[model samples]
Target: MFNQAESFPTLQVLLYQGLKKITVVEMLKTIGQDIGPSTRWTIRQDLARHSVKTLTSANAKEITAEGVIIDREGNEILIRGNTVVIATGTRAVNDLYERLKERVPEIFLIGDAKAPRKALEAVAEGLAVGRTV
Candidate 1:
């Protein structure tokens, strides 16, 4: 989304999570994983260049006829837009693949089914698979 934000004239990302520096031990204990520092840096740079407004510690509270209301640290903010996108994080799921792999002679898993990452990575994989087909 950060990379594609340039296509939208106005885009705002409201994240309910807080941005803070934490110890490695705290991170591993709480989240059990971390987004690599280099990837974070690249995303930050892309967001900065693309003019993607980010509201950290903000969440969507309600959607009324007026617009979408947000709670940013207890302050109510009304944002009026044609579209509202609620983005949850991505995770890999291979339940169907597991069930069908043995039954099907040839089955190729691409994109999120293989591993959840950026869209470009998935697209590249899809193109490669399409060529084989």
Candidate 2:
């Protein structure tokens, strides 16, 4: 009964209609054009196909997202790598990282399990960790 392709647009429209005020804050300076050449093309194409508009370099404060507070500024944005990947799961187990580090010379911990954070932080950490691994 729930088709993602059909439901996503309906959900977006509902959010727009239901919310009296809505602001989009994109931490990334460039949307869909800075990941990499190929990825840039894909993102650009997808955005165009979906008619999604994005605002870049927007600073937000006092934000309650998914029941968590987010504080961000333009200067505080971290862009160490040229790619984006999402890794989602339960909170990171401290013992897992420590135990793995003991058994393996190269071990890196990432995402909310390492510390509860937004998807953006997790993605950033994953990218940083992936480069080392």
Candidate 3:
């Protein structure tokens, strides 16, 4: 986001530039990193994925399939049915917003967008320029 005044002038100019000779799919593909969704949204399920139920605590970092804690402190580690495991990647700055957007809906992001290159120092410079300009 830019300052209140600078935020929309460029966007307004682009919007008023008259319709381009591009198809909707072409435009969405260009804007959405060249990959569009293959199918429409559906209230559907694929049965190949299995589902299991278990009560999980915030501290239950990892566990085995048979409802067993792989390494944790619990005196009542006694009885239970099958468990479930989900895999996720380590956190990186950009993708965290993509994943957690629903949890925090009012969101905004900005930086050296059209700049030719991306790097740690370049990102820092972009943020600094964003703050000032």
Candidate 4:
């Protein structure tokens, strides 16, 4: 079991078998959720069944032909894979919003394009916008 207690506020990812499955777990002590031993054991068993390799506390430094180069507690670990999926949260790129703002006087921007946040926030924003409209 790879403990990611050192890196907080960063996402720790586990890629299984050449991009067959990707599991993203947040490594923030303040915001992290605790998983019981049984749950962890079950997860391990499932991964083992599917031949999924788990890399813990891995901070991706770069992507290379070998796979993703990660920094784990100062030691570099390379995860070999044919496919790599990088899930970097949401971003607010309001190119369309800016363009439409001139043509449409009243416009509401919702979701990640407006602000990169949780689905709950986006859903709340959507409901608020819907009520206004």
The lDDT leader among the candidates is 4
For all predicted structures, in order, the TM-scores are 0.42, 0.34, 0.19, 0.54
How would you encode candidate 3's per-residue C-alpha lDDT over 1-133 as one tens digit per residue? Answer: 7566645766665554444221111112122232235522121111111111223322333355555332123433422335333432223355655666688846444333333233664677767767775
Models ranked on TM-score: 4, 1, 2, 3
How many clashes does each candidate structure show, in the order listed?
Answer: 0, 2, 0, 0
Question: What local lDDT score does residue 33 receive in model 4, on the 0 to 100 scale?
Answer: 27
Sort every candidate by lDDT, greatest first.
4, 1, 2, 3
All models: lDDT? 0.62, 0.55, 0.37, 0.66
**Candidate 1's TM-score:** 0.42
Candidate 3 has an lDDT of 0.37
**1 versus 4: better lDDT goes to:** 4
In model 3, pairs of residues that clash are none
User: Taking the tens digit of each residue's C-alpha lDDT, what string does model 4 give over 1-133?
Assistant: 9885555322223333344655432223211224456566676666665565555555778889977777767887776766778864556998999889989869999988898877888899999999997
Per-residue C-alpha lDDT of model 2 across residues 1-133, encoded as one tens digit per residue: 7555657778776654553322334656766433668668876665654555444655443323232122355344332223233222346567877767878767777787688767898899989878776
Off by over 4 Å in 1: 1-34, 90-133
Per-residue lDDT of 48-125 in model 1, one digit per residue for the tens?
554456655556777788667777667888766555656546789999999999998889999988998868878999
Reference-based TM-score, model 3: 0.19
Task: Give the local distance difference test score of model 4.
Answer: 0.66
In candidate 2, position 110 carries an lDDT of 77
